[model samples]
Target chain A: MLSAYNITKNYQTNGRVVPVLKEVSVNISEGEFVSIVGRSGSGKTTLLNVLSTLVRPDSGELKYRDDNLALFPEKRLNRLRQSDFAVIFQFHHLLPYLSVLENTLLPFMSSLRPVSKQRVQQARAGLERVGLADKADRLPGNLSGGEQQRVAIARALVKSSRVLFADEPTGSLDKETGKQIMGLLMELHQEGLTVVMVTHEPGYASLAERTIAIEDGTIVH
Target chain B: MNLFTIPLRNIRRRPSKTLLLLLVFSLGVMSIVALYQVSLVVGYSLEKKLTTFGANIVISPATEKLSVSYGGFHLGDMVFDVQELPEGKTSQAIRSIKLQDRIAAVAPKLVSMTKIGDTSIALVGVHWPEERGIKSYWAAANGRFPEKPDEILVGSQAASKLGMQVGDVVSIYGKNFSVSGILFKTGSDDDSVILVELGVLQTLLNRPDATSFIEVAALCAGCPIEDIVDQISMKLPNTEVKALQNVINQRMASVHFVQKLALSVSLVILVTAAAMIGLSMLSAVNERKKDIGILRSLGYGKSQVFMIFCLEAGFIGALAGFIGYVGGFGASFKALEYLALSEGAVPVFAVAHLLLASAVFALITIVAAVYPAWKGASVDPTTALVAL
Candidate 1:
């Protein structure tokens, strides 16, 4: 289980406190698809960022299984992020210099283990899953928007990450393409991977196993 | 290809600015190379003069002091005692005795005062025949050596003053002598002197076996002049051999000073090149702000970004240096075309200068990139994601 109890975040901007999340509490189970829905500037992305260990919340209890994420050291959190949680963003965010296949294998760069054939096989399988195996040779600029988003999804799944915290993964896509990506997330959830996505679209958020609606830094559900 | 592409893309994104910066740095490197070539030419020429000047000693006599009074005779004083050519010896007599062996060649001379048309004439007698053994003064310009016992070859400047040339006759001490040759203008006293047979000069002036001074050539430049002077002084205590040795030493010192001056100029030019590299890199970093932000957000850490920028500067430095080296050597070859030089002519440009400029360019460029690279690397990914 993933849980956050009494989470708070504040930014010192222009010498004033900008609170994005305050005293929010939530929990997510394994193999569950939890989508966060909120208005713009309602702390939806902040909530996802806190869950993915990219930012630490002030005065919070964040627990994964029995390990409290708030208590884990930064290196330990990074290890967990790289191995267990794959973070994705609205933009494909691929490194422009590298090819699609190389971008998909970036997570394991820090690890001492050589990029084995099996790892490449897994990356190719993920690309095949997104139907972009043939486009793996191209740079991100050469790929279409829909094709690039599929590459991003494939990159997130290439490693067996248990929890994928994707912040508005389809926000830059059209309705039909966003639905198809949402369908891909549902398909991953059905295959026993946990997913938590932040979005503004109600129809997409409603398709999740459970939806957490937030507003003004507080959860309304 | 992956290693080279990112920075290449960054350079391409701002073509005009990058090209301008590259050219600025290249010009800085080129100036240093040009200065190096100049130093090589002037320094080598001066060094060769010092090395070759020692095999001969140009002498000026007292009394008439014609060579000494006007010839820029810088040697302060000469130690002389009435010395002889030794008994039963001919030309070999100069190097036969242990003391005289140090004397490789002798150009004996006499000078006396005489009046000619209300003006005084300094009658200088140069032993044209025996002078060859010592001065090897064959680098003459116009005519033949002093021959026919009374003929004279005057210095180039003195001949010009008298409106005389080869075969023209000039009155010396009320005696007319044909100017057989006008010596080359070596910026030395020989340009003003009249050379004649020593015996004839001594006879004409009625001073048989009288020499106002003597000129001797040594075996080599580093000859033991001090020891030789000490040995000869025991035999001729009134001679000032040490004084002449001191004069030669001072000339050598002047050449050394010029070399050091050239080196100082080169170092200043090198510093300017370094500054050029720094400015180019600084400009390049300013242009790549957005691209650096994107690369960082895509998961390249701080150190990786720094290495990438430095590597890019290194790339430009190597290319610029290579171009300067080719251009520098080519220019050096063209410069030496008309100058008179011996065979085995070594060009003055040092390979070390080219390499040093290249290394300095890279080092300074990296230093220049430091501030901007840090700025680019430290930019927050969240803020950068929103930036155009």
Candidate 2:
């Protein structure tokens, strides 16, 4: 369960204020697979980032299960991101120096405790689920674009988080690979994982249980 | 996995950057260490050479002299008396002073005028063993120091004036003594004098158990010369004990100047090394902005990112410090050799000094890297999504 009310975000460039997101509001129920669809410069990704706590809006009240995340301190926000929320960026921002398994386990590295054997095994299983088990020890630079996106998915799944935010997960992949990635997300959503994805593709938006089409920083439907 | 390992992995990932930092820092540290080591040796060697000027304190029997001029007619002073010090008693009293350990040598001398082949010359009697400690500058142009009491060492000017050669017999107050050595010209009173045994000269002068004056070479480098003079004066109340402050000040000034110059140059080098490390780390932070953003998105705190960068700088500092120390040790000997002072100087490779230097350099590098690390940590997590 996540919600945002009257969220407004602006960008400043060369002393000029440009509104990226006007007063916008949306809500999603538990276990719902929702897609925020918009063209380029439509503030769809900005809305997703604000809801995910990656970016703070200039004016908004964002709530996640009764807690106003906008008012949370940075430390608590970081803890929430580590424990209950994970993001899969379109670019699959895996550290080039780390192996696939290491990148999958990167979320757990923030903890002071050493990653447990069970946690590592879970990470390995997540990689296997993404069809990257054999490439566990290979660096991200050594993987194909499609495989790298899968590693990003495995990283998100390894957190065992309550919410998964996918920002154009197939944005950089070929058409067939993008279809495969969408199929994986569909299966993940079928397993009762809450997925909030941002995509401009109508077909992918149609696959979601709900679609919130945003135009000029406001959700139209 | 942890802060330490993460930075090390990143460092290994960027070899050229790490090496650039290491080379700059190492060269700076090497210059500093080499200057330190060379200054140490130079200070020691200069002190030793200046000590050869010798006899920083003098003790003589206190006596009075009065002028004999009257009615515009000027006359020389009255007391031409050779007021002798009780030989055994005066030396024992000097040795019994409170600061006895500061005394390096106590050479007693008895001076007398004597004729050699109708030429009048000053003949001095000295205790040979004690005189050798105070006179390290002495060198023989001819034979050697007198091994027997009946032998004499003739100064170069005195030998030339008296027409004397080594192994030639010279008579002093009707006693024949063989010249065992011709002294090198020292440009002092020593160049125009003949030296003989103290007891033999006292007996020849018919003032047995007597000494004209005593020269005490105190180890005055770190000791209080005035205090030694006061203590000696207390022990021998009948004698005048004086410290040669001008000589001590001149020598110590030279030593201090070398030490200060070395310290100033070392400070400059240290600052330059810190700046180099800082600028390079700042550049590194700029290049790794994406990594910083990614880490922050993965829930890594600002403090954690700051620590990782600082640890990377500390690692570079530790390695560079070690390499520089070893390089400096070898360079010091080469420098000493170039200065023609490596013969008797043995520079020590002390482990404590190495550890101290490394720790200091590491701290400097860490401080230098703090701002850059902070900048990296301050990167916004939202930057991670910009590529999408």
Candidate 3:
């Protein structure tokens, strides 16, 4: 479980201080599928980045299992990300030079812990779960947009991270492919995977067990 | 997959950039290797040629008498048990010198007083073959060299003073000698002497196998002339062996100057190569910003990212070094041939030197990549993903 208290993040743009997150607060319980909905400039992605420990809040107290994540050093944060967290980007962000299987195995390769045969098998199983088992040896460049996004999903879940943070996971896919991706997420959530997703689509946002709305960098409800 | 695959895959993905970096690095290494090898070969040949210029060491019997005279005046002084060099000792003493391979030539001379038509002149007996080796630049102005034991050669001054010509028979100590050649004017002690074979002059002077002094020409460019002199002195304890410091110093200075110049040039080339690799790596970092961010998000630490870039550069450097060494060695041989400087076979290739070159290049490359790799590792994952 993770919790935030009065998180405030600021961005400096050409000598001007712009507030992206203003004294925002939220709590994510274990095994809960939560979706954050907001307009284009509503600080939804900024909130996700802060919660994921990818960006530090200007002023906030973020806790994971009662441990102060905000006070942890970058090295500690990296370890936490490696062993306990996974992030899915809207653009997939897969390394173009690597094949699909290689992309899925990247987390294990980068982890401080030595990769085991069981971990490799788990990554293959993750790829199969995302319906990309047949495309494991193909490069990301050779895949369709939906297939690339599935590879990204497989990559995120390969290490069996406790929490998944997805930022518009199906933003670039066609409606039908987007529905398929959402269906996959729904099935994973039913299997007790904790997912925190940010999206602008009302229908996808409504699919989560809980939905939080934000307006002007503050939680509205 | 292992962590090493990422860098290897990245290198394979960008062929043109990697090849460009490899070419620049190899050219720098090639220039260094070729210049060093060429300088070594040419320096050796030049030193060998310089040995023939003149004698740098001299050996003579130690004199026991001292002159008690004013300037140009030989006031009478007592000679206490005058000692002369033993016969047949000059060659033996010279042979005993350490580093004898470095001794280019040894010319032994026996000087005796003789008369030619009522005029007293210095008759110098020399080992002709060794004298020719020492004075490689000597030439005859007229006629030809003396090939027979009864034939003799006269300096220009001696020929003019004695009114001698080729085929003229001259009497020396009741012996008839035909003038076979006249040497060119050298403007030295040689110009005033009548030259004859050492054996013939020793027999005529009634001092068989006697040598008054010896002149040794040694290649002391990389060796110590004092050591050779000391060895000669040790061999002939009653002889004074002296080194001509000025000649040896001049030769050594020239050889050292060439070597230093080549080394400095090679260093500059190496620095420029490092800078080229650094700039290229910087460009690569900029191009792969998103990839770095993704790797960080996936759990790669800063040091891991830095190491990946360094490994990529090191790989490029190793490949370049191998190619450069082989190419440079061949180039050096071609350079030597083109300069027409060396006459012998090329020097043997050293495996240790090749490995050292490769290691040096790899180290330089890794050092050059440090700043760029640090920059790559410092990329903020949040901002990088947002920008992408």
Candidate 4:
């Protein structure tokens, strides 16, 4: 569950102002499947960054469960990132030096909360769900682009995070792998996992329960 | 990030590099400490040799004194001040026989040097046992310096061991001498040494005008060292004071040159070791860039990253210091084993050196780590996120 009202983001580039988000806002309730779509330089990624709490919008009353994310301290934001949500970039962004299992297990380092047996069981189940149980011991370099994305998906589900924000989850994958990934995300959405995915493929974007189009910082609802 | 687990995990990932760092520094430390110990041992040994030479007013043409000199301008490192003669110089002081003009005082020593073949003994020569022995004298056991050349003396223990009488003509080193006064017992080489007159010993050793060495008592009132030697050489004229002074100065220069060379070489080695530490840490910082990013993204603070690299460098320094100190201590023990003064002695932890090295290591490690630690810590989370 998330809400933002009249959000605006600005950047000072070599003495010139560029607005990334201009008084645009949206909301998604629990178990909602929402897609944000845009062309290059259309502020799609910036919108996702703000929604996932990775970056705060310059002027926005961003409320998650009635709490302002901009006012949350860095430590609290880190905890929020650790357990409340997960993100999937087009690139897997897994640590190159760590094995896939270690990459999947990283969120626990920021969480002081005890990692019980159930957490390990959930991680294994996620790995099994993504068909990456055999590849758990490998590093990201050892996997293909498609397989790496699968590992990122597994990592997202390992923490049992309620909301998933994906910026082009299938952008770097082939058509068959992209379709398979979209099928998995839909299954998770049916299982009451909220997902907000950004994609270039209209076919995939149309599958979402709702879609918001953004162009040069304005939302065309 | 879990602080302990992360840094330690990185070490296992690159084993050879870690060992390379360890070995390079350990070698430096060992060489430095070992040579340092050698210098301390050599200094202590020289001091022991000086004490044992056992002569007061030890004059040896100034040039000969330079044969083994350590600290500043040397004259047997005057351990004790010379005993000034009593006031009102009279006939009692005017008793000497050779080079009478330059010689201010003359005393006699007749000592029995027992021959290896027979019970008979030959005599060695000496001077006023009182004057030389008065300042900080060697204890005499039995026989004393003879009152006359004809009167030979023996230590009391030697007298009993030789089974000879006062009037007997004892054969000593192929010369016969009458055993005169027996000495009171004192423990030292004095038991074996014999004392005699400058004249008799000159005759026995077949040198008519010279004593074994002239012990110049610089008692000439208001005279510095070179002045006294100059005045004595002027009296003799056979040995030029200028030539002798030149020789002594040359000898002193050579000793200083050798010590200077040793110091320069050690300093170069220390600098090289410090440089190696810097280079290794810098290279390691580059190699671990990806790992650093992972840690930073995982919520490791900038200070935490800085500390990890600093600890790595500091650990190397501490390890090297430990290696060097142990190496130095081992060397010192081996050298001490050769000494009769100390038997198989070993050094305990010198707290002063330990503390000094700790501070030095801390300084070097921090200096060495600063650039590398800063490089590791200044990683942009954006760029680092891309690395991940």
TM-score of the second chain for every model: 0.48, 0.66, 0.81, 0.46
Residue-level lDDT tens digits of model 1 in B209-308: 6666666554322244555555544444444333355545654466456556756875676566656655666665565555554454334556666676
Candidate 3, superposed: residue stretches over 4 Å from native: A108-122, A187-192, B56-125, B150-179, B187-189, B192-245, B252-272, B345-347
User: Model 1, residue A83: what's the lDDT?
Assistant: 75
1 or 4, greater by lDDT: 1
Evaluated at residue B294, the lDDT of candidate 1 is: 43
Question: Fraction of true contacts reproduced, model 3?
Answer: 0.53
Model 4 ranges with Cα > 4 A deviation: A11-17, A110-122, B1-3, B9-380, B383-388
lDDT of 1 at B371: 72
Question: Could you estimate the TM-score for every candidate?
Answer: 0.62, 0.76, 0.83, 0.56
Tens-place lDDT digits, model 2, residues B283-369: 888888887877777778888888878988888898889889989888988988888874475578989988887887888899999
- Local distance difference test scores for all models: 0.67, 0.86, 0.86, 0.64
B1-388 per-residue lDDT for model 3 (tens digits): 6777788888889899788888888998999889888888777777777777778888888777766888988788865664556556677768766678878788888998888878889999987888888777777888888888888889899899988889899988898999998999877788888999988998888788778888888887556787788888888888888898988888877777878899999999999999998998899889898888788877788998988888888878888888888888889999889988775736458999889888888888999999999998888887677655
Rank by TM-score, descending?
3, 2, 1, 4
Cα lDDT tens digits, model 4, B73-120, are: 444533333222211121123223123343333333333344634655
Best by DockQ: 3
Q: On residues A52-130, what C-alpha lDDT tens digit does candidate 2 reach at each position?
A: 8889999989999999998999988888888788888888888888789988998887644688898889999999999
Task: State the local distance difference test value for candidate 1.
Answer: 0.67
lDDT of model number 3: 0.86
